[model samples]
Target: MQTSLATSVPSWAVGDVTVHRVDEIPLPPATGPWLLPDATPEVVAGQQWLHPDFADHEGVLRLDSHSFAFVVDGLRVLVDTGIGNGKERANPAWHNLRTDFLERLTAAGFPPESVDLVILTHLHADHVGWNTRNVNGEWVPTFPNSRYLTSRAEREFWAGYDMEEARRQMFRDSVIPVEQAGLLDTIDVPAGGVEIARGLRLIPTPGHTPGHLAVELTSRGGAALITGDCIHHPVQLAHPAVGACVDIDPRQSEATRRELLGSLAGTDTLLLGTHFAPPTAGRVVAHEDAYRLQPVPAA
Candidate 1:
């Protein structure tokens, strides 16, 4: 977890589907302490497996802000959009800033206009910031040709919930513009999850948000999962009890993490972390009692 943005985009192949990691900004050191308060230095140090790549020898957790891109069934897709270039925000890290995200996307072989679908895992400020971009004097949908998809429960829950000014401002700039353009669509995610295309599915993994989702893709018997915020960092795999401060329901979040990890353990499925540092993709292997990620280097 170097803090610098990579020049070459790293990608992994899941059967016929190739998932690319689109680098955003590497979150500052403070992000670890604030986001996962329970992942203290001592707690992080105990998990020796996280060293060097995921955490420093001193036990500071390494985290990043990025998205996964790939193509499935003739559809050029982007799982989640990272924080946009320039925007007003209460958080110092996410406030008005500039980054070469769009250029990076193009380098990965999927330009904004070429993307057929933009799958939003949830409506978090950072997750959906790129849903729209500042155009001229107003915010507008960045991918006008793309169909933005998310779970129906996700949008409805945020609609009725009391949101702070920061959140409301985020929606005004990043989310509302997409909706007003009539490009946003919601789907009912059943218990078994809903398949959108031949090999793409939306699995409901609520807790972070009532409608939070984890995208799943399969082709030729090979499979991969894009963990939105359900499993934020690799450390969580070792200590499933550790939950993010942003979780709406800590209990449910823990349960969801356990279930997802349990099902993937000892399987060949590749787990691509939305916020994981380099070697962002891995397989969940059963460790002592819980599980640990067996890093899968991108091909």
Candidate 2:
């Protein structure tokens, strides 16, 4: 089946609660050097489903996808907004490109204006790109009524340390405007977790950023954890210690990755990685000594 059509199924038996994967963004190069030498480009390219001429750039570009969430509570809710429309983006490949993200969301029964809550894992450009819409030179919250939630640490870090020119653009373009419009909420990351609504909870997973978080949902005695960028590539499952160069604190990121992987593997948890390939939702399987992703079949 085609990659897009492959993920048409939303609800799946993830332990107890039903889970779904709503792809808000898509990337090309199936294999590149995102992790480290351990996850070689050759190995990633060998995957049958991966595209050959993935990204429009040289040096291992990957055709990957971005994930948001749709929780099956009594009410419909959203997790994160993938890279949105119309921006003077940095990366040549991702810049000024048009995507059908909104359409895809609508196709999956989520209209931009209908989203109940948007839980951003972090304030990164890719994660917050679709938080707002361009309305006559002003950036406004797309989900005007929906509360856009983020962690306090993440908000403070980006607000103070966005020194790089590109970063400033991301904040100025995607984040600050949301706050100005009174749609952003900075939540406390307590040990027990912060309840967004009835069943949805913002669970702190930290490390990738000062306040990186994961969303955990419990209903009908079932649960699933939406891992933001804690685990970027599947190869990380093989070597959880290798940190991404984009990580703020490599050591902390590595530690978190190891702990999260270990903890989740011990349970019947449904693991979801934002930058993982299509059908991004899956479960962990003990492989020899470590663990690997065993993606549930597409519904």
TM-score of each candidate?
0.97, 0.85
Q: Tell me the tens digit of each residue's lDDT in model 2 across 184-273.
A: 889899867788767778888778899999888777676678888887766666667756768888888888888878888856667776
C-alpha lDDT of all candidate models, in order:
0.91, 0.70
lDDT of 1 by residue, 74-161 (tens): 9999988988878889989998869888878888887899999999999998899889887788999988899999999999999998
Which portions of model 2 miss their true places by more than 4 Å?
Answer: 1-18, 34-38, 41-63
The model with the greatest lDDT is 1
* Residue 191 Cα positional deviation in candidate 2, in Å, after optimal superposition: 3.3
How well does model 2 score by local distance difference test?
0.70
- Model 2 residue 129 distance off true place after TM-score fit, in angstroms: 0.4
Clashing pairs in 1: none
